[model samples]
Structure formats: structure tokens, C-alpha cells
Target: MKTLTALFTAAALALGANAAFAKDVQPDEVVKLVNAKTIKSLDELKAAAVAKHPGSTVTDSELEDEYGRYIYKVELRDTQNVEWDVALDAKTGEVLKDERDN
Candidate 1:
């Protein structure tokens, strides 16, 4: 029983270490999606993320395709100097997550 519990704990840690690394949509695909109006522009997505934490400045961002979902991930630093992680749906400009980074 202890061995099984250990395996579960280790697996969870491994998964958490690399939470989003499966499929990344290519740059060409990103342009196509934007032109086709299937997804919002990266600029738009970034703005949406920043709006989540007012007075926050974006530090880094990336577009990824997670199991067919176009996710826009943004890292930011707020006016108070707190780091944050934000995720948005590229298509609808929805804020999926807004968490403060440790």
C-alpha cells in the first residue's frame, strides 16, 4: 500500500512539473487562425490577460494547442511587484486562469 501511494505522489509531481508541453500550434497556424477569425489576435489575448490583474505588465507569453484547445498563456508582474500566471482561451478571449505565482 505504501509503494502504491508513493508511486501516485511521484507521478503527480512529474505531471505538475510539466503541466503544458504536449502540442504547440505552429506560428503559421496562429496566423491562419487569426485571419480566419477562429481565434483572437495574440495582442488581444495579451491585453485580456493584463486586464485580469489591473496594473499588471506582461512579462512573457506563448500560444499553445492543448488537445485542440488554443490556449494563450501569459506571465505578468503587477504594480505591487507580484508575479502572476494567466491563461486565456484564444478563440473567445475567455480568462481561463489567473493565479499568483510563488
Candidate 2:
């Protein structure tokens, strides 16, 4: 029936969206790239982020390739309990964005 067809369509769309959002680079590949000096190591980037936000602890991190450019994103919580989102250039360990989460 039309109702069943609509349900299947909705399910397909949901799965497609999930797949798009699940794009991520493998950790070992990332390490290999860093070793080859193609990108800065995650540890160096994390250290830079920690230095930028003194007394903050990193909670999560991710590496992404967008438009052929590698970017590193990190989430942190400061001593005052404020959440911060930081983006860094994976190639040079530069800070691209540092924003406080609402």
C-alpha cells in the first residue's frame, strides 16, 4: 500500500543520512599520515588546544577530510565547566576555530 511504500522511503532516507554523517578516517591511517609528515600529530594538536584553553580537558576528538583538506576537531571542558569546540589545521597544527558551546 501507499503507507508501506512511504515507510520504506523514509527508512532509506534515514539510512543515507546516517551514512553521510558516519564518514571518518581510521586512526592508524591518521597516524601513518602524521608519520609521513603530511599532517601534524593529534597529540601535538591536542597540546596546542590545551595550551590555548588553560585548565581544560579534552573530551572528544575527530579527524576529517573536507574538500581535500584535513582538519582536526576537538571538544573540551574547562575548569569552569564551560564546553569549548576547537578546530585545527591538521597539516600545520594551527588553530582554525575556537568557540564556546552554548
Which candidate's lDDT is highest? 1
Task: Give candidate 2 misplaced runs (Cα > 4 Å).
Answer: 1-22
lDDT of 1: 0.90
Q: Relative to the unseen true structure, what is the C-alpha lDDT of residue 16 in candidate 2, on a scale of 0 to 100?
A: 85
Q: What lDDT tens digits, residue by residue, belong to model 1 across residues 10-100? A: 9999997667554777889899999999999999999899888889999998888876788898999999999999999999999999999
Models 1 onward score TM values of 0.81, 0.76
lDDT, model 2: 0.89
lDDT of each: 0.90, 0.89
Best by TM-score: 1
* Residue 9, candidate 1: alpha-carbon lDDT: 99
In TM-score terms, candidate 2 sits at 0.76
Root-mean-square deviation of every model: 2.9, 4.5
